[model samples]
Structures are given as structure tokens and as C-alpha cells.
Target: MAKQKTAFVCTECGSDYRKWQGQCNDCGTWNTLSEVRLGSSGGSGAASARSSALSGRRGGFAGAVPESRLLDDIDCEDVARFTSGTGEFDRVLGGGLVPGSAILVGGSPGAGKSTLLLQTLCHLARTMPCLYVTGEESLQQVAMRARRLGLPTDQLRLMSETHLESMLAALDEHRPRVVVIDSIQVVHSDEIASAPGSVSQVRECAAALTRFAKQSGTVLLLVGHVTKDGSLAGPKVLEHMIDCSILLEGSDDSRFRTLRGQKNRFGAVNELGIFAMTDGGLREVRNPSAIFLDRSDEVAAGSAVMVVWEGTRPLLVEIQALVDESQLGNPRRVAVGLEQNRLAMLLAVLHRHGGLQVGDQDVFANVVGGVKVLETSADLALLMAIVSSFRDRVLPRDMVIFGEVGLSGEIRPVPSGQERLAEAAKHGFRRALVPKANAPKHAIPGMQVIPVGKLGEALDALEQ
Candidate 1:
């Protein structure tokens, strides 16, 4: 018998190697290489025939030749999209789900990844043919959850299978307009001689399903498992094969979940969808700004509010900072839902420019409502919050602040500044301290626009 083919593959970057190594040469990650079996060189004739038939190729170079055309020759018409019966889900998908698109949704266990998809597919089944294929759960289990969630069970089709060939056969028989595989990790292909969730199995199964979706114009929704590090648990190549990649994130303590698009070919990747996990199911949070800004009645010293632009809309989030006397020689600088490096740099800027020394204090920063602030627009608000904590003074409760503080203490403008200010004003913010360039020419009604150009100027405005 011929020797079975084997190759070492890197789980981090999907780099292939002939032999096992301690570290991946491509991504520099240690202990991520795993052996993948590629089947025997001298397989049975039946297996070879099955492989060839599944690939739609009878023999070598037997397929029709393709012709290349100029890019201008292709149609430029917009692709049609169908709603998934969830506005937040649709918003994260750029607007709506496109026909023939392959979408991957990944999250931690109990993060409601399956629940969200079930609700969507159930609603869509009323209008169009939809299928729910589960390899991770029994059909009865899915039905029980659906019934508990109060979803309609009449039209939606359900299947429980892990074999890739059998799933494809069922797809051929059903010809559904929408199909969801409640997870890609458990599905295995017979062509690959490996257990399910292996790199080869995941790559092959996802590729085949994506190809079928493209050919049949079916909306393919794939649920994926996340690693302990909160990343998708599979070969990195799987993300490249899909049209969109979305991650559902929620902490155990919080009742809210956030859906964010990491990659999208049809829409913007920066869009965010917020959902509130209820007893019935995942309900969409239409006005996320209100929920995130749900602060207590009494204002505190170390808390301040800021406006952040999430994709097409503006979000109002609170920034909090605590400055306490350090007990150790080296002060601890911690940031939750914010970048630690940026926090340290902001502290340095405050000490140098504003003449406020916090080097001997332990500084902790947090964004309210578990919202991660990745933009520099939170700089001014963070600095103000820090100063408020240091001085033990409470900022105006109706005030909003957002601006980028540069290394030289100059405040910079962020994108969609006018809209951000308007959003804050709409939310009953009376005063605004923003970059001078971002200040609106006309005064906003029921709002005081306080534009500051320098860090010192902002500090002076806070005192007044």
C-alpha cells in the first residue's frame, strides 16, 4: 500500500510545513503546528471516483476553458439583498443578506450565536424556503429552543448530520433559498482522513459549501466556534473563503450582546449591532446610545460622557477613570474596554501639558456598558475624566466631550464631528467641549458648544 500523505499545518496562519516545528515561521506563534492527513496516495478506485465526481471533474484538464474579459465589460448593477428579519443583524451585514453570499458567525459558547440564527431563519422561513442543518445539536433540541423562544415552526426545515457528503445531498434535494449550518467545525468530509474540526476537514467543508452556495444562489449562513482567545477556531483560510465574518460578543455578567463585522465584501466592516438577551430570545437594541448611556441619577467625580461614531450612527458612551495613591513603587495603569498603551500615553500628555502629575497614582480607566473605544476621539473625554478623579470634582452631568489629543497637546478633529455633536445634543447634552475644527459655525439649540484648541484650554474651561 502507498504511504499516507501527511503535512504539518500552522493553526495561526495556515502555513504548511514538511515537518513539525516548535514555532510557526510565518506567524511566529509557538506550538500551533498540527499534523494533517491528506489520505493515501494509492486509494481505492471508488474513493478517487467519488472525489472527482464531487469536484465536478471527471479527468485531468477535461473541464471547459474559461475566457477572460475586461473589468468594464462586467455588469455594474447593484446586487439585491433580503432582510434577515432582524434590523441589527441586517445592519451588521452592511444592509441585508445578499443572495449567494457565504456568511460566517462566530462566538463563544452560550454567547447566543445559535439563538440569533435560529430566530432569523425562523422568521425568513415564513417568506422563503430556509433550512437549518445542525451537526452540534439534535433536531429536537433545536425545536425545543425554538418553541421556548416562541418562534414559528411550520415552514423551517431542520436536519442533524455531520457528514459533508450527506449534507450536500440533502441540500441538492431541498434546494432551499437559505441554509444555515450550526457550525462548520463539527462537519467532516470523507475525502479527508481526519477527525472533525481538523484544519483539513474545516477548510474542505467550508470551500465545498461556499461553492455550492455560489452556484445555486443560496444564502449560506455558517455558525463557527470561537477559540479561548475569542478568535474563530479553524484555519485562517476559512475566513478568506467567506463573503462576511461577524463576531457575537457578550460577557457572562451582562445581558447585552454586541455583533460586529470583522470582514465584509458587500458593506462596511465597522458596523455594530447591539442585542439584549431576554428570556424569549435576542431582542435588538434600536437606540444603543440610550442603553449605553444609562447612568445613575447622581453624577460622580470620575465619570464623563463622550460621543463615538460607530459606522453610520453616533454612539454616546461614558468614560470613567479612577486615580488612587499607589501603594507600590511602580504605579499600575489599567484600562478596561480601552487601550492600555493609549491610557499611559494620555497620562503622560496630561502631566506634561496640563501640569497634572499622576505618575505616583494608580490609574484605572473604563468605558461604560462594555463598549470598547478604539477611536482616538475618546482622548479628551478620558483626560477630563482622569482630571476629575484627581481633583475630586464632578463634571457637569449634561456635558459631552470628544476630541483627539495629540502628542503636542493640540486637540484634533475626528470624522463625522458635526453629526456626533448633533447626536449628543439630541440626547440632552447641554455643553460640548470639542476640537476647534469640529465646532459647528451656528450655535446648536439648547446646547453650549465649548470648542477648545489645547489641553490647557480644556482644563481652564472645566474649572469655569
Candidate 2:
């Protein structure tokens, strides 16, 4: 008999240590170390091998192994997809689910991860065999949700199981083409001694399921829980083990939800899928721009519209800013749906070069409709909105602006200039103040393009 060994693992960063420590050396978080016992792999090798072999009974590890072949020898023209009947969902999955692909969907609690997956399974069940296996929720509870959504329950099979071995047995028995695990954190393997949701248990169970999915040619959808910092919980290796990772984000009380593809092996990365939550379920928002933009004729001060590229689509979003005299010694700077640091930098540039003094004012800014403005293309619009608020002047109602501002006060060009202009034109925008480099070869019909070489030129256009 061999003496058992124990090691400490950081739940936050997944770094392991030889002994227990008060603070994690890797992530610098205090008291995140959890003890995990290491078991001998000698005697259990045969039993574990038997377990893996048995787990792959339904065409698991034995059948789906790929043979070594040259790139020229492979044929990929006939790759098939399992369409879930939802256009937005399929878009996020890179034009539908590929056979034997494992996808991990993660989000904050109440972000509607389970609801979206359930709705998808309902649609997939109509065409092919689909199973919704819930480790967190009961079968009856799932049935209630299906009834509430008015989804037909004839084709989809519901199972409530947490044990990994039993789940594999069910997979072998049913052989559904598409299967969804409500959450990966709850499912536990018998081989791991640590508790469920622990580092060792999560890693081993996710690996086992990923192997099973690859071997059986099943489209596996695993719901992952996010940490307090909005990242997927559990070991970082869990994210690397999947074929694709999708992040579902939005406010809890808001009706909007954005599905962003962070990592995709078979499809393009940074793809976006927008959905609107309703009583029936999640409905696809075909024209997301219309919802984000305020279409009223009234254009107020401190408001400007800019075209932003979310993946390949150009969306027009309204940027709002408010500047008020501060009574405190240090003026407050608050921004929602935009980075505060970026705002501070822009303010600095505005004062130094653009001749806008905002140091004495408590600055507040927000992107309308809860859409986060990550790209610097909105730089001109943000600064314009701030100036408009400070000067009590409203910008032209028919104009759209987008250009990246530099520290030296130059208006830099952004990518996809043609697409952004076309999007603005579609929305009846007649004038655009863009960077000189982004000027199109031919003028866009029904729109006047004003190319600005510097930040001051952009302000001159608004004043005129």
C-alpha cells in the first residue's frame, strides 16, 4: 500500500501548491486554497480503463478517433450541421452545430443560460433526437418550464442525473444526436475523491464528457457558471477542452441578451447573437440597431449617434453625456457601458488639444440601451457628446460620426468604413463626419460625407 498525498489548489486561478498556504501565490487572492487528495493510479488503472471503455459503449472513444492524414488528403466539403431552428443561436454556433462538437455556454446567474438552452433543445427536438439532462434542476421542473414556454414535449427527452457514470449510461441508452447538460459544475465523477464543483472534479468530469462527445459524434452543450468577475468558473483548462465557448451577457432586469462567441474551433471568432427575452421565450432580434437607437425626432444636447461594428454588423448606438459643476474637491467621473479609463484619457485630450475644459465638472456618460462601446471608433462621438453637453448645444439630427481620436488630437480612421457608412445611410442619416482616410472612393447616395483630418475639424463641422 502507498501513502496518499494531498495538494492544495486555488479555486480562483487553478494554480496548485505542494502544501496549504494562507494566500495564493498565482492570483494573489487570500484563502482560496482547497485541499485535494491524490489517489494512486496503479491498482485503479484497470478499473478506470474498464469504466472509460464502458462509458464509450455507444460509439464513444473507440469509434471516433481520427486517423493521421495529410491536409490535402482530407475532404471537408460534406461536413453536416445540426440546425437548432433558431437563426440567432445557429449564428453564434458558427452556422449550426457540427457533429461531435462540444460547446460551453457560460453566463452570470439569472442571465438566462438555462432558458436559452432549453428553448434551443425544444427546437432541435423537432427535427432530430434531443435530450435535456439536468443535473441542477428536476425533471418535473424542466417539464414545467417547457409547458410554460408551450414547447411540444413529444420529441425531447428529459433526464435528471448528476452522477457522471449514470449520465454516460443514459447517453448510451438513448443515443440522442443533441444533448444538453443544464450545468457542468454539478455533475461529478466517481473516480475523483474531491467534492463536486471542486477543481479536480470539474476538470475530470469535463474531460470525460468531452471525450465521450468526440467519440460518440454527439453535439454536447454544457452550461457553465460564471465567477463573480464574470469569467467561467472552475479550472481554466475546462474552457480549453471545449470546441467553442459562448458568453451570454446582459442586465438581469433588462430584456436584451447578447451571445458572444469567444472561442470557436470550426467557425469565426467574435460572432454575436442578440436575443430579446419575452414571456414565450427568447426571441431573435433581427435588426438590433433599431432597438438600440432612439428614433424620435427630438435630438437633445449631449447626445450623438455613432456606428459600431459588432462582429461584421454595423450598429448605430446613441452616446449620451452629462457635465455638471462639482462641489467636491475631486470631481466624480462615472461612465456606464464604456470604460472609465478610456473616458478619462479622452477628457485629457479634449482639454489639452480640443480646448474643452471639463476638470471642474462631474462628468457622466452612458451608451443608450445597455450596449457596451468597446471600440475606439466611438471616440469622436463620445467627445462630441461631452462638448455638446458642456456648451448646451445639440448636434445636427441628420449627422452620424465615428472616428478614433489620438492623444495628439488627430482623428484616426477605423476599419470597415464602407459598412459603417452604409448602415448609417440605411437609417436615413444624411451627413457623416469621418476620418479623411476612411472617405469612400464614391460618395454614398442620400448622404453627405465630411472627412476630417483632425479633431478640431470635426468640431468645426458640428458648429457649421
What candidate 2 gets wrong by more than 4 Å, as runs, is: 2-38, 43-68, 76-78, 295-297
| Cα lDDT tens digits for candidate 2, 78-145 | 56986778888888888889999999999998888888999888878888888899988888988998
Error (Å) of candidate 2 at residue 231 is 2.2
Please list the residue runs of candidate 1 whose C-alpha ends up more than 4 Å from where it truly belongs after superposition. Answer: 1-5, 38-65
Relative to the true structure, candidate 2 reaches a TM of: 0.92
Write candidate 1's Cα lDDT for 1-464 as tens digits.
77788888888888899999999988999999888776677657568889878987753211233567999999999899988999999999998999999999999999999999999999999999999999989999999999999999999999999999999999999999999998899999888888899898998899889988987889999999998989899888899889999999999999999999999999987789999999999999999999988999987899999998887788999999999999999999999999999999999999999999999999999999999888899999999999999999999999999999999999999999889989998899999999999999998999999999999999999999
Score every model by TM-score: 0.94, 0.92
For every candidate structure, what is the RMSD over all alpha carbons to the true structure, in angstroms? 2.9, 3.1
Clashing pairs for model 2 are none
lDDT, candidate 2, equals 0.88
Give me the candidate number with maximum TM-score. 1
lDDT, residue 268, model 1: 89
